[model samples]
Target: MFELIKKKLKHTDGYPYLLSILEHCLQMTYKRNGSQLQQWQLLDRILQQIVLQDEKGEDPDVTALENFNVKNIIKM
Candidate 1:
């Protein structure tokens, strides 16, 4: 990775922002993991609802959360 970065810097007219790439990837990974964690939580909640349905007789909503905007999230 360091050698690739060095080669890119030498071959390009302008230097690529390595720190920016690193930062963006780090943030993107964090966001991806966060989304996965949220999904797991949602699944767990749904399963719990199913398990408790005999006692509580409640139905879980099949709809997803509505407030998350993809464009806004990507801008971050």
Candidate 2:
């Protein structure tokens, strides 16, 4: 999951679908225990990196829907 986010943040090309994933993830953080659903140190770092890059007036990585191949994944 983090890998996909990192990849998307690196080369999203402003795709709406990809941008939506981040929105969804941000929304999910509102759910009970959702903040702990998944945690990857790399992902945290990637998000930070994306934020820093964005501060430079550049586009951050966006994620595509196809990139999420969820299977039997339950949300807390």
lDDT, candidates in the order shown: 0.54, 0.53
Stretches of candidate 1 off by over 4 Å are 1-33, 59-76
* Residue 19 lDDT in candidate 1: 57
Clashing pairs in 2: 8-61, 9-61, 18-63
Tell me the tens digit of each residue's lDDT in model 2 across 1-76: 9677767666666566666767766764434454344443334545665675655676454442234433323343
Error of 1 at 9 (Å): 59
Give stretches of model 2 more than 4 Å off: 1-14, 30-76
Residue-pair clashes per prediction, in order, are: 0, 3
TM-score of each model, paired residue for residue = 0.31, 0.26
Colliding pairs, model 1: none
Q: Each prediction's Cα RMSD?
A: 16.6, 12.8
Weakest ten-residue segment in model 2 by summed lDDT = 64-73
TM-score of 2: 0.26
**lDDT tens string, model 1, 1-76?**
8678777785665455655545554564324556645544554555565665665685554344355444433334
